[model samples]
Target: MTEYGPRPVDRRLPTEEARDLMTLVRELADREIRPTAAEEEDAGHFPRATFTLLSESGLLSLPYDEEFGGGGQPYEVYLQVLEELAAARLTIGLGVSVHTLACHALAGFGSKEQRTERLPDMLGGGLLGAYCLSEPSSGSDAASLTTRATRDGDTWTLEGTKAWTTHGGVADFYTVLARTGGSGAHGITAFLVPGDAEGLSAAAPERKMGMKGSPTAQLHFDAVRVPDSRRIGEEGQGFAIALSALDSGRLGIAACAVGVAQAALDEALAYTAERQQFGRPIADFQGLRFMLADMATQIEAGRALYLTAARLRDAGLPFSKEAAMAKLFCTDTAMRVTTDAVQLLGGYGYTLDFPAERYMREAKVLQIVEGTNQIQRMVIARHLAGPEKR
Candidate 1:
């Protein structure tokens, strides 16, 4: 129960309120989302129904202002919802995360009029969004993006490609970054493009080892026209918007990692407690017990790190480096925890009969997305260097 206040102001609240929201989120995740995660993932089915249910429950826009039909919750609370969602279904959780990321560009930079009119559908109900930034030639160096946005009288005609869009085909809108002037980041501009805009087409979804339920594809924009009002901030401000949004997005990914590690720990604990070995339950083994303790401890530590970063951001403090650090720590923790969970279960864990393997696969992607662990390290090191070369 964070006290209501103007945004970016850290507030005091009871832990119980966040706990209550977590309880509600968990119920939906475990009961509704988890059951279908695996099968639909295998079949590459989209979870449009889950998004609708989330919208109905007001979970999709938990961090926005109440005036726009949002839950008016703090980022700290909103991220926990993401954690609970990911623990059950990574794909749906990611879908929610990217949607939030898409909203950030508009929320952080758009005019009051834009927020009042456009934020309702995206921040409330019956809407989905994608953040489009990474291009084929520009990933870590996103400033080098070559997407062209030529102004044709009052309308902007965009021509370029966006790689690794989380909801490439299914999203209702996209927060896209393109080149509006000369080369480099200073030329970049952000736009909110509708899904059905003429000349906007998505490539076939990429074949991936995990997160199949969440569609990932390349978006191609060929002379797509948009109203000038769709511009999200001034031209050349897109890079800043993208980077800031990713700072929060990294925290979202970190929270999901914590949830995943905890889920793997839960599965390992229950399995060991029931399975017998040499006249004693496998849970009685001291070696395995120590492994579980480490996993639990890591998950707890990761949770603390991410929450600390979220609080810092809420306080209007400098938290970009901290966010990267949390993302790096938590995703690595998930990868290790899930792998250990599988080892504890032996052969069963190696197969799809159990959830451990799926968790293991999902963990790998979190490390790569929202900026790779390598990129996170760079961010941290640059912050450490003060204002000199960072």
Candidate 2:
């Protein structure tokens, strides 16, 4: 019996350590994640224990600095690990991405004192995280967020709601962005808030078409107070921090999309080679063969696109534009390739019996998350054409 998911992906990593990391990730994915992914997803199970296991294995902290309890891996290697986990189960992949996004503000902009005090627990302390930037009225327009944080003496009180938060209710901490100055992007600031802070609560998770195992909900803050020491960066620097985080976060999304597309292609290839059609294998048909070839090609192209952007990021070059392009192209590829995988499977693909339909549904969200593909095009165009005139 051939494995119907997560085929080997030849990678060009810069270090032998990275090669070993990938091997461990694949072994864990096959043993701990893949065999039960469908069942757990169907049950809407969050797999908190699995996240703890990942934390203990150092998988959750691969891309950050080693001084802060991270693995200190390059972006390229980290993204490949994300692709592997995502290929097995998207909830875990996207979960790790969001957790990293939540840590970005403190890791990149927090003071030395802050890092010394709090960095260890966030990286590998078995505590999950959530990023709170998008509001009900502001997603693509993140700077227009209305969540307010009013400073009083040495503390700040946060009020208003944050929407579309992944890991909303379950996270141990939240990296929140709120209006601390005026109305525009310059007025925003970031804060690290504990999950159990007074006056902070999460609404029921959204009933979505896919990714049910990962919770997405609204977080309400009514006069929640935190000490000034918990604030990340300077006042009115939150938008810049949020944008920086999104640039990296988009690459994570791109990697995950390729994983899903790769998984779908693997399933289609296995099924086509076995299922007989009119005394011949379906894989023998020229038309079916072409579709499989196209799917494989698309997955490869998407993987390469994301990897190129990741290398630029690791080299300390400006990668926002390339990240946007990768996010846009890779997600679209996942959507197209997964749809073709369904078609290749014929009647069996439409039902829940096979994973093709699930992959198709999951791929749709990748286009919409980490900024919609439409928003990505706008970012890329602005980088190319420059920002619009007043």
Among the numbered candidates, top TM-score falls to 2
Candidate 1 local accuracy as lDDT?
A: 0.87
- Model 1 has a clash total of 0
lDDT, candidate 2, 109-153, per-residue tens: 999999888989999999999999999999999999999999999
Among residues 3 or more apart in sequence or in different chains, the pairs in candidate 1 whose N, CA or C atoms overlap within 3 Å are none
lDDT (C-alpha, whole model) for all candidates: 0.87, 0.93
Query: Which residue runs does candidate 2 get wrong by more than 4 Å?
Result: 1-10
Residue 219 displacement (Å), model 1: 0.5
CA lDDT of 192 in candidate 2?
A: 99
Candidate 2 — which pairs collide? none
Candidate with best lDDT: 2
